[model samples]
Target: MAKYSDEFKLKVVKEYLTGKIGLKRLAKKYSIPSNTAIRTWVAAYKAYGNNGIKRKRSKEVYSVQFKVEVLHFMKQTGASYQETAIQFKMNNPRLIAKWNQKFLEEGIEGLQEKAKGRPSMSKKSKPTKQEKEMSREEQLERENELLRLEVAYLKKLKAFRENPEAFLGKHKQSLPLNSKKKDSD
Candidate 1:
């Protein structure tokens, strides 16, 4: 990827602000590979003025709390991905959408970053031979627990039909999670 200087970005943004030409013309004139870059730059400029469009020094690592807050803000404002990304000064608006998707699937824990690379085998306790041959109900329960958040709500609805008692049982109490909404309204 070509690394454009902050000065060049600023100049392009200034030209864009003048509204003399559209993104395609500006990109073609400037030999930019894609007009998307200009669009982002324009949004960046609008949100944070000069600072938003500036190239970042390094990859940012957002805390879970920050992720939750961003999700809340996006939901509260009913903002588009691009708009939320602009407000957050994020280079990619798609990231906000990804965070929202994960948040929806897994609750707050979905925001937690997993360890990079292969998972440590040492951490997992190998299941006993007898434990391996679990009953259909047990297997379903395990699978449900593993991907409860990743799968759609319809799957959970199916689980309810399979075993209404299990779905309404102490399973929820065993894995305690705080689900209180923090409304920014």
Candidate 2:
């Protein structure tokens, strides 16, 4: 569709509102593609004033629930897309039409938000049998190292319990500054 400036839209809308000319004549006078465009613009102008004819800079994101509700309202009331949009205070009636098309084509899943942008290049590949075996071996090694550290910790704990003063004396030089202060306290 040809993009019309806000000023141009306002001019067309004003002319249409003058009660002299109809939609088809105005469309022909302005060389618009269809009378529906003029009708949509007039309806939007009536509903939202000057801001209705202006183009939106940022796209709006509608929730899946909201889309479903809009479709449901359209279905129950048997209203046209433009009427439904006006009733729901939505700016874009064509958006409701697209949502309806998607719903019909793919059911609810079609109305769901799709991820945009390029797909990730670093997709993970499935591990081979050899790679899985190596992972298992590495897991066992990690477990063994943890068990050794645990045994060493238990031995040191037993020595500390056996002779607290001796343990403190032996490790006093190696202790942290805070630990030394705490022991002194």
Candidate 3:
């Protein structure tokens, strides 16, 4: 995909908005690759005015509250990812989709951005402010997920201790068990 400067996009949008030409002719005249780009620009301009035509930076950090608000609006309106991104002024719609996936799998906690590299501090020493303020239901859900994970880890550890050879078998994908021998009558 090609990047268009705000000036170029605004020019195309202004030409289209003049009512003197349609999108196809305007795109050809301006040498824009996609007529869809013009249409999107027009829609964005109409919806958000000059700011809509301005290009967003390639990468941005969104707050968890912002992510949650977007998700809630999406749920309330049943809007598609593209629609949500447009409404929220995001250049790429896939971001809203990834946020939605994280929200679904990990709840609001998943929306927060994690540290990029190795952590200097351990999370176990103290609860974060967010954790401290968590509602009772939210806390229980988090604890439940943690307990389930711990159980699975213990189960795997037990299997590894019991049958190191079978556990390391090619089908380790399933569980730690080796095929038991069948006794013939």
Q: Give the number of the best model, judged by lDDT.
A: 2
Ranking by lDDT: 2, 1, 3
Best by TM-score: 2
Model 1 lDDT, residue 115, Cα: 72
lDDT tens readout by residue for model 1, 37-152: 89988888888888887766555667665565556556655788887775555667877889889988987667877877886566557866676667666978856754654453
Query: How well does candidate 1 match the true structure, expressed as C-alpha RMSD?
Result: 11.5
Please identify which of the two predictions, 2 or 3, would achieve the higher lDDT against the true structure: 2
For candidate 2, what's the RMSD?
25.0
Candidate 3 per-residue lDDT, tens place, 1-185, comes to: 44888988998899888899999999889888879878878877877888877766454666554565567557755787767767665655667889989978986668767868786876598877876767666989877865664465457557656775675453334321221222323
Error of 3 at 25 (Å): 4.1
lDDT of 3: 0.69
True-structure RMSD, every candidate: 11.5, 25.0, 19.7
Lowest-scoring 10 consecutive residues by lDDT in candidate 2? 176-185
Per-residue lDDT tens digits for candidate 2, residues 1-185, read 43888899899999999999999999999999899988999999999998888887665667555566567657755789998887666668999999999989987668766888898774558878998999999999966765664465557667767886786566544433211111111
For residue 36, give model 1's deviation from the true position in Å: 3.7
